[model samples]
Target: MAIESEVLVIGGGLAGITSALAAADAGADTRLVSYKQSTLRNASGLVDVLGYTPGGDGPVVDPFDAIPSLPDAHPYRTVGVDTVRDAMAFFDTHAPRYQGHHTDANALVPTHGGTVKPTARYPASAAAGLASDDRDTLLVGFETLPDFNADHAAAHLESAGVPFDVHGVTVPFPGDLRAGAKVTRYAGLLDANPRVSVD
Candidate 1:
């Protein structure tokens, strides 16, 4: 079946969600399609949104303002000063909604340069440790630099007896895993799980 939408978001990852939300907010009829229960479980979960905050317990150096001084070949050099400033402003506006009293009170805030406590939305300890009988097994094919151990994860799944499956797909991009390459891998994962309804 062919579904129509003004903005068809193919992934529910951070960038996708952010895009979908922004598009919808801008009056687009957005539809987010995901092949799994969440786009949060994969590499997206590894990202922490709490990089910097106003009144944060960290060094308080604005990453945007700091980007311009980096070496000529630095990734930030391409970002441009205006982009960083805009991002900093966006974060300044939205961060308060997610901040918690505990985070605000934390003494040591961790920053890129040093350790400084920053407000974050990580799962609470109790929630993180909760036992789950249901599990989804992802079968990753091909190797990339900084490889992850799927064998250990699979062993844990087997011990838990959670539902699982394995499959393989070739990587289109060989050698380096850049931003565009990662998106390709994400699409592959979605293709493998066609049953999921991306909403």
Candidate 2:
């Protein structure tokens, strides 16, 4: 079979997906191709614009402000700040679950590794967990999943000088899945049983 597309985007990662979507939105026949699973499959789903500069002086407070200072050879510099802003706006319009574009400042999001990352856009569900929000937060980790240690994450957040009181708790998951199960397996189980509760 022969396939024809006005815009053929290679790969299925975030950049490719965004390009394909943009083309489609512009009334073009777009096609996306990927050899393997999407890289987003293992991603945290956060849209990071610029986290830090090459100097590694500190986290970026505003991606737009920092982008100009990036090295000339950097992708952001080559694309220009306005193009980056447009790309983020396009992402915001397509991804309704993500909340961003209201401000130029970056939001500090707590990661599973207990480290806080600065991102321009993030899932709406994680709004409460932003380090800028000065509310007591509780991080819950699964006892079966050894990759994330909630208590350790909380301690790390505190040590990093977060503006909120954070605590961690390890709880048993209400399922028969083994401790060594992959994240996809856990996600599948949860999708199959949304009401699964720990007694």
Candidate 3:
């Protein structure tokens, strides 16, 4: 059998894009599938990769600095320290140049201002801009206590001169948050969306 592609992504979120680009750069024909235009339209858009690390130029959180506590049975737990270091280096090398740029050289750097910085390269400004530029954005609002109404988000997008398609999703809830059933429900919603198609 011949190798078809270096990577085949099931979802078209930041992870998928980055993976596809990396694979394609490595000379691979990547295919990405998603329920919506891309994962950028969903809650993945709201992702904030900021978090505290123990060893850094800024302050550290000793408690959170601890590595994965998963048992040996967990595959991720087997990752070597060198692998993690190499990944961090790759991220540092690819960080956006404007991230560290500042208006006042004397003032603190905006990127370094916050105690917690983003782990992902996708900038909030860039994500927001993409959402704005794209027409007929479909924001699937979940119908629950913290439900996000499609019309509400649509209106805000409209005022910002952004076109959108809105729909509300009714997620099943067992009414037990601590049990962790909600996680599966949300995953199901994303799985239901399809790329190159509309719901």
> How many residue pairs clash per model?
7, 0, 6
For each candidate, what is the lDDT?
A: 0.44, 0.87, 0.42
lDDT by residue for model 3 (1-199), tens: 8866656887777677667666776788777777767635444222222133323433222211333643565333467445544554454455553221211111111121111223333443444334324444444534442434555555555454433442333343323243333444555555665331223
Model 1 accuracy (lDDT, Cα): 0.44
Candidate 2, residues 39-129, lDDT tens digits: the string is: 6988998998888888885688988998888899999999999999888888888998898678999899989877899999999988878
What is candidate 1's lDDT per residue for 58-168, written digit by digit as tens? Answer: 433344444455667765577676764455345444444432223322222212111223222323321222122133434343344124334544454445433444222
Candidate 1 wrong stretches, greater than 4 Å: 1-5, 39-61, 91-96, 100-199
TM-score of 2: 0.89
Look at candidate 3 and tell me the lDDT of residue 38: 66
Ranking by lDDT: 2, 1, 3
Best by TM-score: 2
What's the residue-level lDDT of 55 in candidate 1? 38
**Deviation from native of the Cα of residue 63 in model 2, angstroms:** 1.3
Best-fitting candidate, measured by lDDT?
A: 2
For model 2 the local lDDT of residue 109 reads 93
Poorest stretch of ten by lDDT in candidate 3 = 104-113
TM-scores of the candidates are: 0.38, 0.89, 0.34
